[model samples]
Target: MLRRSPHHRWTLVSRVMVGVLSLLALGGIVVAFAAFAYGRSAARQAFDPLLVGAAQDIAESISIGDEGPVIDLPVSAFGLLSLAPEDRIFYAIHGPDGALLTGYDGIPAALDTVQPRFRDWTLQDDAARFVTVSRLFSERAYAGRIYVTVGQTTRARRAMALDLTRRALFVTTFGGIALIVSALIIIRSAMRPLEVLTRDLAQRDPYDLTPMQADGPQEVRVLVGALNRFMGRLDRQVGAMKNLISDTAHQLRTPVAAIRAQAELALEDDAPRRLPRLERLVWRTRSLGRLLDQMLSRALVIHRIDNAAPTAIDLRDIALTVLDSRDHELLAPGKDVQLRIGEDAVVVLADEISLTEAVRNMLVNALRHGATPVVIGVSPTPTGSAIWVQDSGDGPPDAVRATLGQRFERSAASKGNSAGLGLSIVRAVAQAFGGEMTMATVQGGFRVSLTLPHHGAGQSQ
Candidate 1:
């Protein structure tokens, strides 16, 4: 199976979505980080009130002990922590002597003695986190600094952080998917009018060089209008050209008819002396008429196709038809004519009648000017179709080859009336189809290549 490229599949939509998604992902990352931070702050803020209450209770419960030089805590001290779930509470009291005094004696020291009372400190214990506060009794009765510290475990804070993190991820993952789906829907909807234009265009045939219908957004409407005007102009130009060719043909017919009558009247001379001259005139007149008819017909086709669209032309079938029509011309024994037809379908946007005439003109030129075996081959190149006409003549003189573009003004009134427009017609047709024509000096004769635009006609042929 062959794979269709992304360029051929979803190029426009993918490009649009990539841009939207890049910005959306950036915003999602920023929001996720902010949510993580906010959740952490919430977990921290949730514990602050408990810490303040613990401090106040420890502050109020202190009193002189039964013994001298001491203080005590209320039995309700541990009960302060029971209000908050999963709270790990630790408390300690220290006298001015720096000795372990009351509360959990194993509880570590919490403050610098020189610091003011009511100051709080934080420390990380082995299995718990603690917040400690120190106070001083500066009344005249007792001048000593004592410390009261309160602590709680960090498990609750950590658990709350994990929960917030999950919420952030959950919101972002589902939200991002929703955003993508919504973006697709919006993009397709916004471009829906363009699709209508596409269908309108797809319904048109190659030979139908009609005005494009206008039904789209502002920009597309403008484009369609311009194309329609161009098509209208093209159709008018083609109509004018066909009329011109018909008129030219009609005008030529009158002159050729008059010339034939004059030649026949000249043959009325009973003397044999006038017979050869009269016969030559009649033959030359007939040839001139034939040439004129060919030229006018080719000119009309060229001019029309230049302005209008060309229908699909099967070059392979046309070549075969031409070759079959001229098989005896090419294979007549002793002429040494060669015909090499490659086995591939070469289709192009062209006129079948015009293309056949073009090929016939080439063969006629070869036969008229050169000896056989005239080599005619049809093949393809990198960019287009190429038809070759190589005759076994000495080719044109170097001067004539170099001066091909020069108008043959001096030869217009010649006896044979060869205006050298056969190759020119081929060139014109090629140019109308965005192809090229080239002539190269070959060994025995000349090689003329009538290159036509390839529509990938033989890729799967």
Candidate 2:
């Protein structure tokens, strides 16, 4: 059964827009609330002073006459209260003894003090605001105090507050929407570089491993750098694999053709002559197998050189291990492979498997081309460590020796049976470890040495 992968919910731009819009919306709501409160307070401040002026005018109309306190409500007082025409106006006058002298008896005086007071109350079924003013009448007939009260329904004040709040709401709504839209546009513009980068990567060829340009914001540049490094590693690995396939096909062609020819000859011969032909066929098959083995060995050495991390390896131990392996006996039968080690430890930085394969190839090559009694030795050089294979025969000519480590280039002494990949593998291993391979004629015999840099001598440590 197949299962589907989960899809991504949001992209970077969407996330940024959502976050910014959310904050703006929250801020807009807070601003709206503050506007409502400020509008209500400003409405009260503006209208309350008008209500006080009306009450004072009504107080000034009271007089201490012979009968008692005479009150005549002024038309100017009513005119002032009528400024807010939508509101209902009411007024009342009271004697010092709390009796209603004139005007409406329904209206209540809030305080008995001599100072004016303003308050809010319910009149009939409507909300109302009122102001009360008290005055002293000190005449012969009347020597006491009088109270006057004025009130108006709150329709005008509520209308003004509503208008202010509507204006604020309109402005904030449009401004917040404009800001959110502007933010989205800016976000899209900022992400243009990433979009271009994505398009470039998607359109690239599968084998392309070129590094991308690190041009963008700092965070994006970091991502591009990592991608470039990864592509570099992939390029090297792919190149190694391609070389492996090409070399295998090229080197196996000759041996495979020889095997096929010998097989045909064996099949055409009679029983008495077939045996010799079959023997040759078997030998050719074994040679083909050896060629394949060397080709694979060389490919593995190159792969390890490119990919494997190096560790401190003692060259003396590698030499001894190569000498003790069964390959030595199989390649040089009835001959003991000698190993010589110096007094000091000879350590170099290298991959152990690659180094061992290189040494083994050198041993096999010496036994195949030179005489018996091959000596594998390790010693500390002035710069690093040296391991060499010395045998009892003169080496190839100087011309062949100069090109010894090249792939599939064998000496005149090496017949067609030789794969010619042995020294090439050795040289690759030496170069991987910051070393070099040298060929020399010494003691009337051939010597091939791999000189490696010391582990603790440089940055390789």
Candidate 3:
């Protein structure tokens, strides 16, 4: 079974989506980090201001209140700490005499630094619950020095940290979800043009070699141009096939009619009395057979060229066979056809069957159309190998030499008698084998050479 043909396509939306989502995800992460940083800074700002005020209040009242060397505070002083959620708040103030002045009397005084104004530290309660804070107040707040320490339960701080984390996570997830959805939609829309091109190709008839009209992006335009080139080649091949059919049909009519007429004439017993007509009919049949064979060979050549047939064979053997096959036309004729070698045996990698056929065809043309002592030379060159056939008499007419490798081309004088595919076949064979056939004017006549790939193996003759 044959594999299905692909109409390749591409899309802009996929590229766009990839870029957009990548950038947005990155931006969202940065924003989340920035927000968390700001919140942490703001919490420190709020905590420090409140703690400093409480310390100042205790410092100012340290001179005396109801009792000696006491700092007085309202009944709602502890409620200031209770403003935060489900937290244990503790405060301590000690006079310069080293006696507790306010807040918890049983709580030991924390080791407070004199210089560090506000920092973070941890302390354990009687319940072994730890509270963390770092704060200090100087003697500038009152007449006597007072040590005041303030901290809240860690459970509340833990809850606040959890809340901030949840908010950051929510923003990241929401941003990611939004970006993903937007990316999918944009990608689809951008690629829709390619999908349209695909549908256009899918609806086409397989045999239709019509050019595409869809105008996509620039790279897509290049792809369309390539498709157009393929379509052009296909169109030319179809046209060639049509021309072949027409030519074959026209050529067949005469021979088929002549054979029918011959059979009809022979039906009468008096046919031998009409020997002239029978002889003419036999000659016509022979010419028709030769023409048909040439026509078939031409078709095969065209087919092989269009499909790129492999052509690797030994050229040395093909050269020998060609000389052997047409010995009578070459050596036995008054004209001599000879191969002069710079080397005895030059082997080549080529299509041997086609090469031999080309040689035989060239020699046949030389004998019938040119003079004696035609040289058929085989030699290897630095680049490739070559076969040169130079006839003694005047070479092919100017028109034949001019269109040497063209199909159905011939010299005007030889048009009626020659099939005109010999040189064409040679060229086609060369092309199929990834080589070239060329004609050049030599010292006395013209030379036809088929240059093919050399295998670099030979001996000096």
The most accurate candidate by lDDT is 2
Q: Model 1 reaches what TM-score against the true structure?
A: 0.46
Better of 1 and 3 by lDDT: 1
Q: Please provide, for model 2 over 40-130, each residue's C-alpha lDDT reduced to its tens digit, 9 standing for 90 to 100.
A: 7998888888888888887887776677777777888888668798889988888888888887777868647777788788889889988
- Candidate models: Cα lDDT each: 0.67, 0.84, 0.65
lDDT of 3 by residue, 350-420 (tens): 55555777877677667666676777788776667777777876666666577866766767666345667
Model 2: lDDT to the true structure: 0.84
Error of 1 at 251 (Å): 6.0
Model 1 score (lDDT):
0.67
Using TM-score, give the best candidate's number. Answer: 2
By TM-score rank, best first, the candidates go 2, 3, 1
| TM-scores for candidates 1 onward, in order | 0.46, 0.58, 0.56
Pick out the ten consecutive residues of candidate 3 with the lowest summed lDDT.
126-135
